[model samples]
Target: MTSDATASPAGKIALVTGAARGLGVEISRQLAALGAHVIVAARDRRQAEGTAAALRAEGGSASAMKLDVTSEADRLAAREAIEAAHRRLDILINNAGILIDSPDGGTPAERQPSEARESDLRRTFEVNFFAPLRLTQTLLPLLRRSEAPRIVNVSSIRGSLTHLSDPTSPVYPIRALGYDTSKAALNAFTILIAEELRGTPFKINAVHPGWLRTGMGGDRADMSVEDGAHTAVRYATLGDDGPTGGFFFLDERLPW
Candidate 1:
């Protein structure tokens, strides 16, 4: 952990996981554009480096780290690397996730809750819920060293418990059991940790970036990736007066 005296005077330092492409890369791009030294993290080193290289080509300050969010070794190594170079971390985006089952794939019976495999449930939670939780814990020390540390958990509207239970809600009819529940768990984490850090300059939020036309979201989804990246970027770069421990989509506060 770094002391306040050694904190970088440069722009923010941000690490975004699963940033090789899609929503992750978009978030990294926007953060880099905002003058943050964005760290593009992915399970594959080549892909992560490629994404970071592309960002540099666009004149953004960026780098790449090989990080499989699910691995403890990767998480600690990332913390060490960032601490060595930057001392403090201004932003941490827990963006790595999985949607093993989707509405667009498999037979309806295959995707149904009753037919869902235990392996699928565990895998989904491993990536979506547990990975971020553990990674955040590992990096908390570095984040605390910053003047205003922001943590954004890339969540989904499907995580809304109110929507899941309400038949009239837009998300009510849709069900990807494992994926949805995992996001819900992530949302819970955001609330809990935010409360624990309430008096500090930390702002932690679970943001839904809308139904993006990405690999996980599928082509039938409504929003563009550009628009989908907005909410997370907004929260990730929040002001001192910004709300924490909240679920959000754009400016709207979502229900638990």
Candidate 2:
């Protein structure tokens, strides 16, 4: 760890899961640049360290945490470490996700909604929905310690059931059953969590980070990694007056 302070000038402590590459890296960098001591956590320790080091190199306070969001051991270890080191957590960006089904919609037989493998759907939920929900639950103690705790669930437009039903929406045809439904579950989690913490200082919301050119987004995505991270970072750094239990893309409120 660096000799610098554990908390940033903003006096905020943030943990960003899947912080090794793409939007995760960009989100970490943005938060670190804003003087929030960012914990770059990923399944790969080395990659997380690299991200933390890069942030430090850019004159930001950061630390690396090896975290596989799906692992119970990792979730507990992260909570313990944060409690010991920072005592409180101000921000958490649940950004790790997977897209196992065909992005080209359910044109193919096996990839179709009716024929998609249950195993793949289950795995997607484990990573995209269950992992974040469980991790947040595990870290609730530390979050309660903060004056203002922000939880940003990095969701997708594909998760919008309204849009999914609308033939006019761009993603209406791009139905990856596993990926889409997993995010929908995440959205539900966000709403329920926020409802539970409504009068409190916690602000929890799901973010739709637009189509971006990342590993999951593929080469033809319309946005960049930086652009993809904007909404998540926005929700992560929201003020006490900000809205919660909502899905957002930039300033626009998305349909649940």
Candidate 3:
């Protein structure tokens, strides 16, 4: 790993998975707007190119690369592409995820357990947990090359044990067994990784972007994609002194 020992996040290079659309696209847009050279990586080359084109139209340093988060080869190719162009990766946002088939308004949490399927559980964890873990491990050396690196995992309030336990909490009643449990597993990875990197110049954190009105969140959700990407962008560009091994919503830390 090359060392700057003094580089700040400004003018740094960033790679965001699933950056073709939705929250991932929004986060890439915001990060590039802040002067970072952002790599938009997604499974669909066409969509990734479209996003990169949009960013370039807005006068940002952005590029598109085909990256299927679940594929190790795709992950390595993305890393090679980034390294060839920028030499080091300063920010990583593991935002690629999927939600299995659930009804439009969503079945109540109690009812969800009954309706849950085994395939749904496996698929959700495959995308939400395994992929991120694999991608992060593959790109860690790139992250270590930076002077002050940041890793932001887009998690959710539904993953919070505290919120899930408290009967008075809003999220207590909103669990989708597979998706919720997968995010909780992702949250565990965030904490463990952060602890492992303790005392380093890197900050790793999980952010709950609130309920967004994206394809996954449905129309009645409170936040727009614009607002939903804010916490993610913040977490990605956090300072050297910023918090790690923690869950956040904007600036507030949430209970485990």
Candidate 4:
């Protein structure tokens, strides 16, 4: 791995999943602005196109792709498309996630851990944990071809066992068992993969995008989408010296 701190992303290729809107879109915009050819990937092709078009309008190199991370077919198609076009994927931001335990457009409720249904837990894990893992595994070959490959798993502070165990922690009161557990699992995957790829140039880390006012974060979130995307963007474009197998919020390392 080249430890060049001044590395540039000018000729790199990146893919941001669930980038039709919210933090995903912001992360795509930032990566494109940094001179990478970014693929705005979402389940909705039209929405992805719109986001990619907007990024291009801002003088960035970007395109759209349909990627429903949970589907095996979509995963294969994404790999094929990237292989045909860029031939390598330099950066991957696994930003697609969900919070299904919350009530649908209604008042929030305190869901007990025991009250979380098996179906809800399974669906949450499918999207939040398993999907990213499957997609990353599928793209590992392309990522391996890059000189400096990076994988940023967009996690949440709510997933932190350290925070959950502390009564003083702000996330202590927020108990969505399904979402929290899935993110925790995602973080674990980050560590496991980073360790496996330790001697290589691949930099993989789990990041907390901070609580933002997105569809999932609800209206009362403390941060903006732009601010929320900062962590993922920073780690996505990490220099060769950047840390791997870690959890970070912005530049600050978080307790695992």
- TM-score against native, each model: 0.93, 0.94, 0.93, 0.95
Off by over 4 Å in 2: 1-9, 103-110
Worst 10 residues of 2 by lDDT: 1-10
lDDT of 1: 0.87
After aligning candidate 3 to the native by TM-score, how far in Å is the CA of 51 from where it should be? Answer: 0.4
Residue pairs clashing, model 2? none
Q: Tell me, by lDDT, which candidate is best.
A: 4
lDDT of each: 0.87, 0.88, 0.85, 0.90
The top-ranked prediction according to TM-score is 4
lDDT of 2 at 159: 91
Candidate 3, residues 1-256: lDDT per residue as tens digits? Answer: 1122123355989999999989999998998888998899999999999999999899898989999998889988878887788888999999998877465213344337777788888988989999999999989988899988899998988889888899998777776788788889999999999999999998999999988888888887888999999888887877666788989898688988
| lDDT (Cα, tens digit) per residue for candidate 2, span 160-238 | 9999899998888777889889999999999999999999988899999898888878777888988888778788878
**Candidate 1 — worst ten consecutive residues by lDDT sum?**
1-10
* Ten contiguous residues minimizing lDDT sum, candidate 3: 1-10
At residue 52, candidate 3 shows an lDDT of 93
| Model 1 quality (TM-score) | 0.93
Query: Which segments of candidate 4 are over 4 A away from where they belong?
Result: 1-6, 103-110
Per-residue lDDT of 207 in model 1: 94
Error of 4 at 28 (Å): 0.5
* Root-mean-square deviation of every model: 4.9, 5.1, 4.0, 2.6
Candidate 2: residue 78 Cα off by (Å): 0.3
